[model samples]
Target: GLSSCFHRSEGFMRGYPRVRGFYEVLSSCFHRSESPEGLEVYLHALQLLTTIHHGIQTLAVAGGTGQALWTFLCEVVCEDLCQPDDPPFVLQEQKGLLVHALAVLSVLYACQNQEAEHSEADTLLPLVGSMLRVLQYHREVSSGHGQKEKKEEEEEEKVDEQLQALIQTTVEFLSDIITHLTKDAVCELVTRGYLTEKTCLSAVGSLLPQFSPAVQHLVFMLSEADPQLADTVRKEFPVSLSPS
Candidate 1:
């Protein structure tokens, strides 16, 4: 029955006005969930559809259905998934859900941007703030500790691995949206004052070693534009710029 459910939703996503039906099904599934499994399946289905061309086209349509879906994702899904105040143990336990949620949101934002819906930017602003806060927490927890018992040390390692994975996912998500990052977007994020130098450094940690030229150039240009922000970013994590 569950397999049939997924198949039906998949088909719904492949046809006209697909997102509306898919979103309704996802909403219904999430509401009926008494356990994490329902939510997990919902996210899995969302992620799967996002990978399809038809799904992207479906999501790109700006309408009541699209708006509701995005709103629920930013408000409900992300809120429940990311708890910045949660300790490493809690976060480690929920890493799978968090990763899926972020990946889904990332794909949703990509589609939303394709539709050129500037109003959606307002909805996404808070999501970015939440992401930064979560990233900051993960960075703090993962940066090595002084002394602990053997079990504690092992647990810390597990947390570190999870946090690293999340950091990488968040970095890639931000990278996707960075191309259209306007001066206003930068100002809005800065004014929110939730983002700190540590957050920025953590955001880029997983991206630097790949030697992503576009990211490097973007950072270099940003540094030139805002030397103070550059100094703050470099204070802890010095990203070596490759000349090419």
Candidate 2:
């Protein structure tokens, strides 16, 4: 079925106007859907696009044909999917969709193409806060802080387990984006105070132990980009994270 869809949609690869039209159609499906099945189809469509060269270049990249989808993914899709209250099954499904979206955007930003006029920091700084919030929620819920009832604790534990992969995916996504940022962009992020030591500790320090070494290395690379912030991150996390 996916193969069939890809074959049929090849015309979308031609240029910006076609890409924008394609984006509008699928985004409409995503916006109109209230059911999980409905949401999944549109997400699947977006995922399918990532597999194609044009799908990514035309739709995912900044200043590409798919600015609408890019903005929607950043402003709404990610925010909604990061919520802790969704049903477990729904959350699991949303996790896959969000990861796909993140992959698209991360690749776009990392490429550093001249087509996009905006600085990577301009697009990425706001997302760091969203990413941190999701990570903090996962860390707090998984560790179990103030559960008075056994049932509630058990429920939280179950949600915590389901969320494990989601947390890892989110971390990997942010790590890739952070590691790819230009030196000047990272400096701007730090100088503006959008990325503080407290935020870094909350994201990197608290979650470092739980991450696989590869993901940890990626986060470590982010620290390496900024000496002062790196010192703060290293102090807070304090784990051996040598690059391979």
RMSD of each: 5.0, 6.3
List per-prediction Cα lDDT, in the order shown.
0.62, 0.57
Please write out the lDDT profile of model 1 over residues 1-244, one tens digit for every residue. Answer: 5344435665654453456776787777767747677777676667666676666666667765556777877765446666555554445556666676777778767666544553355666677766665666566655643222346778768866766777777777766655455546655666666345666666666456663553555455446555577566556556544422
Q: Which candidate number would show the highest lDDT if scored against the true structure?
A: 1
Question: In terms of TM-score, how similar is model 1 to the real structure?
Answer: 0.70
| Predicted structure 2: lDDT | 0.57
Angstrom error of the Cα, residue 6, model 2: value is 4.3
Compared with the true structure, what per-residue lDDT tens digits does model 2 show for residues 1-244?
7657575665744532455665676567666647546555555566666677776666544566555555666665445765434432444345556655665555555543523532444456666655655565545544564223455777767755646756766777666555555555556656765456655666775455555463355445555666666766666666555663
Model 1 scores what on Cα lDDT? 0.62
